[model samples]
Target: MALRPLHPSTTPLFVAIFFLSFGALLFQFVQTRMFSAMLDYHLTFLVVSGALLGVAGGGTAAAVMDVRARRPSSAQLSIAGAVATIVALAIETRIDPVSSGMFVAAGVAYVLGVIPVLCVSWVIVRALREAPEKSGLLYASDLAGAATGGVLGYLSIGTLGGQGLYGVVAGTALLGAAALLVPRPSRVPLRVGLLVVAIATTAVLSIWGETLAPPRPGPFKSDTMGVPHEFARWDPLARIDVARIGDLGDPGHYAFLIGQGYAGPRPPALMMTLDMGAFTPIVMHATDADLAVFDASVLAAPYAVAPRDSVLIVGPGGGIDVLNALRQGVKSVTAVEVNRTEVALMRGPYSEYSGGLYLDPRVHIFEDEARSFVRRSPELYDVLAITVVDSFAALTAGAYALTENYLYTEEAMLDYLGHLTPDGVIAITRWYRDPPAEIARTVGIADGALRRLGNDHPERSIAVLKHGLLGLVLTRNGPFTSLDMQRLRTFADQRGFSIALDPLAPGGQLVDLASAEAPPTDDKPFFFDSVAVSDILAGRAQLPYGYAVLLTTLVLSLTMATVFVLIPVYRGARRAAGNALPPGTVVALALGIGFIAAELVLLQRLTLYLGQPALALSIGLAALLGGAAAGSAVSPRVPLGLRSSAVASAVVLLLVLGGVPLVTSATLAAPLEARVVIAALAALIVGIPLGTIFPRLVAIVGQPALVSWVWAVNGTASVVGATVGTIIALVGGFTLLGLVAVVCYAVAAMFAPQPRT
Candidate 1:
């Protein structure tokens, strides 16, 4: 039998489906941003995993439930989901994760977070089941809404904050509910009431939500716990909080130490923190004497070697490094910072309080990622300084162990070196750990950069200095002179600091890269990850915090899938005798695993190229889903079988893997606008083929019962595939992850059912 055309009566249903998907995705993005600020950064991944698991649970329930029987309308479910979303946000936002214990708090968040997603999934599934003939239309509506949601989600974070976004999501859901009742004249009054309430609630939340439920820092965060913050701002990159150290009413009580153990004068300053941990100070009422305090700190070791005419300060938070350069008598200084919210705060709100540091005539500021700015810079500098730039919360929790840090990659070092004068030095400071993995990685990166520059002896171009938990690595384009080494040793000795590496001195270079540790490349930029699987298995190193969380998620996902999806579907299929396993089940499962794994790889790869994680995620997801929607719309005309779709997908994945290095090298210095276009095009190319697979498989398994079972299988596989993709990237990088996706598609091709003529 031929499928029926989309009827005019179903227009309202499709529109409601669109809003449902839009609200669901917006809710997910808001949850990710909120939890990222409230808990350890790695927990953000859990948000994604939890949402997918909820999708699986809801999908399974829909498969088992009788949709033909009278049940609650889609409009009723949408409204319930809206209310549940608000309640979940309210509860999760107020709880102190540290006091409640990390696991307990996370468990609470995970359990409550699933309710809204499950509700959304239930509505979508029922819509699909009711209109199997219009499956393509419904799926297209779903993707289009999700694509729009992703782009708007990124844009709204800067304007709405997390709490405000929650309100927007609720309003969107209510609007969807109203749309569902558009065909019923008798429900006109209810529709009008819902619209009015949604608009009013959204308006109130957008105006005052931040004030009512302000984001609180975790106890482990470095910001002051009990005191009220002077200023706070939120954006996609991070949350910036400013706190007055002492009595705000009395200027006499305001004092700042250059660093711990420093005997210099305590200047008046205000504390500025990023993500509640990476702290810097804004100097208030400072004089020449106050500016000179930086000269006494270990961070000034690079400037001590020789007089610098010009300086480049990367991650110059609170303008501390810029002030240090000025105190060293540099003629010009360029400060590049990634977070625009922090820059706005310093330039607009705290200008007078900081003595107009950013307004200085000799100082120039650029709001850009460190590596991207350096790669496109037109001038060379006498010194490049990066001082304790990354967030301490992320570092200590090992949250970034699986994430990319282009700033610490060998390619980034090469970019820095390329933008430095012959005598200029690159200075990087990090918290020193007992095992010194960070220090070793820093040295290895510098060494790799120097070797790539054709240096015969890279060691002569690098030096390391340590003072209390702070370690600084200095490297230059050219070798450090004997006189320069002598000056560094003299400075370290007088300050009671230790020289971990000095080319001219004997027994130098105490920090060596372990044989298993490799210098990070842009392809495998995991600078914080030093523990290998062998080490973990041999009892040489314990599992990192981030990995442990990932394992727990995987276990939970498996358990949920087995209980709610697999067992119920198995029993139902067994009752049907010969139809125990659906013909397209394997293909659906493989598509889910392959599609998500590929998406993750694209997201990670494009983040550095686009210069911001949020931008990359928004553009990548939108382009991919949009392309998939287009593919689904045109699937009927394509003269291809399921086997052809899988083969084509595998070929595209291979092309993408091979093209990554080339694309990155060519676009490393391109304008952001141009890079964004290229990245979108790349993702769209991959999504077109992937989108064709599922709709074609649905046509083969025409029975509603089997179709729902296959949907559950696909959803379950997605829940597990997310964790599996992360592990693959953790072990063998994105290249291996992409290859695994290709293998999955190939396996799907082997199991694909024959097309009906």
Candidate 2:
């Protein structure tokens, strides 16, 4: 049947594959680290372009082997693979910006794309020569190693980190070469001395690599990032990657039942992200509340008990809603929380630390998002107090935020309105900085829209909208007293703030736009309505890219795929029976990589627009994983005749999956932490199916021993596609990445054999 792998003499061929794989991978790790050392995470990608060039060179070598068919001996092929890998790395050193100067960065990346292809080609050639009868054995061996590399890297990198990762890469390669000399009955001993020298060289270089620096705490500081985070000055553009507790209050001491999520330290004031602004009389008299607590700090609440009734406070901190309600005299209070960070601090490390009022036994705390508890709980509040930042638009964008949708939407309004005692009123307060008449008009529209829910105003509710760009509205569906207004005015005056009813023209707020089923989608998304804001706050949205690079890439790709591949195929450069992928395939792969590079360039634009680099990274990582998973799974089952077709399907799927997220504002606004987790889980679910595809395909082509070889080729292709995908996202942007995936699949499809027996 098949015996190439069992022949034992091919051990050298396996060793060569090991050497090349490890060597090239080591080189890449070093390249990456050096860039980081330069304080540049972005530049290494261009260097990766150089790495891919090495891979591309391997592809060229593969074609050369196909032409030389059966002409090279196993030893000859092994020697060639090793020499080629060395040559590729040496060449990379000259062009890689990490080692070379920065002037040729982009050009170097473009040129480097040719190297890895070449190295991969040489390894493939060696495997083929060693086991011509066992078609895919090289692939299995390589992938098995890949699995090992992944696990070891994961476990070790945490300890070793960036520079350490390079050390591992270098060590693995050097050790691999040493392992080759252990086998007997061949010239293994002759190479032992040389292998020792290589190991020594790697060691010496590791010491002088300059990429490595002395260990220090806050490890990212050691990298070449020119400026250590400790030394780095704060800029709004420089987002806070590391989370730290800004303030901690003990809940037992200062109990707060704010609708906003609970966040405070144990035994202190119980509160969340909202630290009280000067919204309360007690807080105004107190010192800490007046200072900007946590950038738009809303309030810190203290819990207390009243004699008879059970009380539910939404936002306990702002102006002491619970304390006032207690004075208004409530028996007990229940609070809801969403942002766990807020609740944990209040309930966790620093409870009772914030203030004196948190010790009340009448207060019951719930650390969950508001709507969720409300949806499940049968208990209704006698008075639901909603304390939020002002100016619906600005509020929606920042921490102290809420929207008109909650009050205006049919479902939301009904939910709160239904639960309200004929006298139970939900209170809301919004904030602003430099508000204008038009801004007031929008607020007026928001308030007017709420009247649809049977909201009644003692003072024609719109009366709360006032000057100073900051206003507070106290709207209710029930009759209330001037005494209540006096208490609110008293609280406001104590906090250096004043409020009066909003002045309206003709019919107040002057508008007809709020009646639509959903928020208006004009130049800017009009989604700050309470209901919509609630949906957003609760984490529901599509999470697609916006200002997508997709549109331009799509058009350019049509022109590109035509020019890069079609031209070659039309010239008969890709006859399946011939060697080297008809030259057109090679050109297409390179061009596809180029297009991907372009898309990566476009992603920067998105980052610039949204001012969120994390979003860009999320998009890039998702596409990378998705594409690798797809190719790995489908490559095996792909019929020789339908290869191109399957790849085409994959291309379209990636495009839809990755690029579509940019189009929907709802999706764009969704938290990436949740979205990315979901996508990664999806990719993981399909991993096994994809992983098994190659084994099955290799089995179809050759005996079990040969399957390993095929797996290697597949892994190599996947690595190529993944690296290229990231580049497209980084350089060309994600749109180009999708296009490249499409192109790769189409290339595979075009190579699909016409049906024949």
Which candidate leads in lDDT? 1
TM-score of decoy 2? 0.42
Mind sharing the TM-score for model 1? 0.95
TM-scores of all models?
Answer: 0.95, 0.42
lDDT of 2 by residue, 1-757 (tens): 1223334665554555555454454445444434333323333444444454344334334433434436443334434434443443344344434344443443443344334434444555445434544433454444334434433433333244434444444444444444444366675665665466456544543454223342211111212222222111111112111112224322322222221223432222322211111112122222333322221111211111112255555535322454444344467767653333333444433344433333456666665434334544676555555554222332432311111122222333334544555445554444433323333433344354455555554234332523244444443444444554555445444444445442222133222322323322221122232223234447673211211112222333234324432332232232332433332233234333433432343333233222233333334323432344344445445453244334444544464435434442233333445444443443333232223333233334332222222332333343345354542443333455555644554554454333322
List lDDT for all candidates, in order: 0.78, 0.38
| Model 2: lDDT of residue 528 | 39
lDDT per residue, candidate 1, 431-475, as tens digits? 777667787789889888888989988888888888877789899
Query: What is the clash count for each candidate, in the order shown?
Result: 0, 139
RMSD of 1: 2.8
- Model 2: weakest 10-residue lDDT segment is 231-240
